[model samples]
Target: MTATIVVPTLGRPSLGRLLEALGPGLAKHRFELLIVDDRPGDRPPLALPPGIEATVLDGPARGPAAARNTGWRAARHEWIAFLDDDVLPDPDWADRLADDLAEAGEHVGGVQGVLRVPLPADRRPTDWERVTAGLADGAWITADMAYRRAALARCGGFDERLPRAFREDAELAFRVRREGWSLRRGRRRVTHPVRPEGRWVSVRTQRGNADDALLRHLYGPRWRQRLEIPPGRRHRHVAITAALVTAGAAALVAASGRRGWTAVAAGAGLAWAAGTAEFAAARIAPGPRDPSEVATMVATSAVIPPVATVHWLRGWLRRRAAEPLGSQPAGLPPAHRCPAGWAALSRPTASRSVPTRPFASRSAEGSR
Candidate 1:
């Protein structure tokens, strides 16, 4: 069974490094590589190896979901393997993937590979990068995931509505499982090195909260809880910020002869400080860098929760408005049982006879 490796790139120069790492594996597996350029202006920097077919597709700057859909659709192979432009595959990745697919019968719908990111030794990560880095080794079912072409066609690929590169994979995985297909972990793995990120990485990543809200809309409130995933702290932060703002405004009003407003403002400040301290302490590591970074993290953390909450709430509201009022929810119920005779039946057993009652009962009744 031939496999096509589909890579969606955003014009990162580091993609050349990813390609170089795949050199040995690609040659051994002889899988076709399809690179979808999400950035229209830039082309892939590296040359394709001999006998390895490569294609580039151009279109408007839609996100990775669209690019992946386009690339997977273009592929002629039965299996389509997706790799992030930033990831470096292990040497036996291809062979292991082939073996994995072989072991996974037709019922298996998708395969996810492990992702590892190595951090730098000298510098402490910014609050935002740390949050993003939390995802590095996180059962990342996105990068290095493979799916059957038929499964993609059935589920209609990733939702184009997911504008960013976040939660799109979860949405797809959820849908595939909902359709009675299974997603298994693959033996193959990839190392995702942490690229140098800007100071605003955390701030920029807040947009993910909005996408997450979309996921909640698509799935339900219980999605995170049931999946054993924690809700992003953004909502809690937002709530605290709202309280602080309200109190501060009330205090200013009270200072102008309104005693109630002043009390409210004072309460608000105390609450904010307490909340900040708690959040900082939880995230703080045990080192000299801990206190400073924790402070920065706390200061920035307050901002994120509210911004994320508002954006998520906006997406949720918009989705609710657009959806038809009484549309049926997606997927089958969790506890659906097979029909009676459909299940394999056990051999019929002989009935055990009950012991006879004593005759003394009738004689006693007659005497009464």
Candidate 2:
């Protein structure tokens, strides 16, 4: 089965690195390449590897979900294999991609490639690295996954409304599964290197709290359970943040000089400080014990919860306003579209089983 390679890029220099490793083998495997540039109007050109036939297209700066929609919709082959630009494919990736779909039954609609993140073995990993490692265990993440063009078309491609990298894949997976097809896991290993990034990146990812709300809107409150995600501590974070804010406000009021307020402020300050220390210590305990690390953790832990809560609230409001009066609750197919008719509206239960095969077994004969 011939497949097309689609990578959505922001003109990252690492895109060149991925191609340097993946390009040479493309010719032998007869795979096609499409890179959707997500930069806004008038970006510079992408200089790809020589001797490779690649199509580079510009997208409406929406985000990875929209960019991917543009790429796969333009694919020439039936199978659209998506790899994030940050990931480096194995030398055998191209051939294995072909093998992934070579024998996919008609009932199977997608194949996920195994992702390996090589963390620092000699030292304790940073928080970001620990989080990145979790991608390998996700059910249908697009980090290194391929979907049949037909399956995508059936779902009207990805919901461009998602407009972000987070949960968009799961959103699509939900709809595709509802269409009565299976999504599988394949053993085509690709390394996702943890790029050096600012410490605040972990904090910045709190924006996904907003994305989680979007998932809840689309898939209902039980979305996390459907996806098998362990319950998050976001609610606890929210509570702690509320206490800290209340304590700070009390301290401010006490500065106006009431003795009773002074005692309350002192108690509140101690509670806030204790909570912050606990949060910071949990983060610090996982990694280096240096002062710089400790200070950074202390500062970020204080803000992450508030930031996450604000975003979640924003998403919640947005979803509530956008949804119509009488639609199916969240992730199920709409009444008109579902084969079960109005019955599907009762949150059609998910059948999560899918086949898994290691593409490594089939591609060994054809790979470098």
Candidate 3:
């Protein structure tokens, strides 16, 4: 079976590095490369090496899920391998993938590869980078996943409603398992460099809570709690709000000539300071040079919980009515349209067993 490597990019020329890293493997396997550019009016530099056929597919700037679907649809191969823009694949990655697919047999619908990261030594990592680093070295099915074209077609690709990169891949894998297909892990590994991110990365990632709500709507409530996915610091939000309210009441009482106001303010200040300091200390390294960064981290800590809580609450409320989950997009080609009168896809039951864990790492060509 022919293989196609689909890379979804946001017009970052840095993505060329990912393609370059895969050159040896792609050339050896004679695999085609498809680059889907989601940016409008911007084209990625097309200076690809010989034997790698690159095509740029344009689609609405919905998100990575949409971009991946667009690229996979444009591919001509029976199997589609997905790589993130920030990953560097090993030289033998392609051959290992082919062998893994062959070993999986016909019922195997997908294969996930291992991801490794080498962190920088000089700089203390920001909280966001720390979270990202934790994701590396784990069995992740989303970043380096491969799927059969027919299986993807059967389940209607990724749910485009997932507006961000987080958890969308897991959601797709969950659906694939529900369909009674197996997803095995490959022995090949990819290196994911820790890119520099702004300090607000953790704060902004609170959007993931909203996405989690969407996943719950699609997969039911047990998935999150069972998977031990922490519901984004909602308890911290309640604590912050309580402290603020108590401080406000204390101020009003003091203005009315009451002695209790001092106690209230002291209590609130102590609670807020302790909470912030604890969060900052947990994330920051202790050193003379890190004091300023530590202070900034502490100051920002209080704001994160409330923002995360509000976003989660909003998502939960918006989806409380149990609206139809996956409706076919309008104006799709006749072949891409969902079957008429087909009942809406329901949440797959947790009792359903996944034939093979999608994220397990195995040997390539029977070699470690």
Best candidate, TM-score: 2
Q: Between prediction 1 and prediction 2, which has the larger lDDT?
A: 2
Task: Tell me the tens digit of each residue's lDDT in model 3 across 1-368.
Answer: 46888887775545767776787777677887777656655433333333444565565568888878876766667678998887888888888887877776667778888888776578766555567776664333567888876556656778777778877777777666555566778887888777777767678888877877766775675766533354545566668757766777787888899877888887986886676666666667532326666666776676776677677778888777654234234443232232322212221222222122111121111100
Error of 2 at 343 (Å): 26
Model 2: per-residue Cα lDDT at residue 35: 76
Kindly list the per-residue Cα lDDT of model 2 for residues 106-184, writing each as its tens digit.
6778999989988888878777777888887777889888987666765666766677777788777777777667888
lDDT of 3 at 214: 68
Which ranges of candidate 2 are over 4 A from the true structure? 255-260, 324-368
Give per-residue lDDT, candidate 2, residue 295.
Answer: 75
Q: Candidates' TM-scores? A: 0.79, 0.83, 0.77
Q: What is the Cα-based TM-score of model 1?
A: 0.79
Model 3 C-alpha RMSD vs. true structure (Å) is: 9.9
Q: Name the runs in model 3 displaced over 4 angstroms.
A: 41-51, 121-126, 137-139, 225-232, 245-269, 285-289, 321-368
| Ranking of all predicted structures according to lDDT, beginning with the best and ending with the worst | 2, 3, 1
Count of clashes, each model? 3, 2, 0
RMSD of 2: 9.0
**Predicted model with the maximum lDDT:** 2
Error of 2 at 267 (Å): 4.1
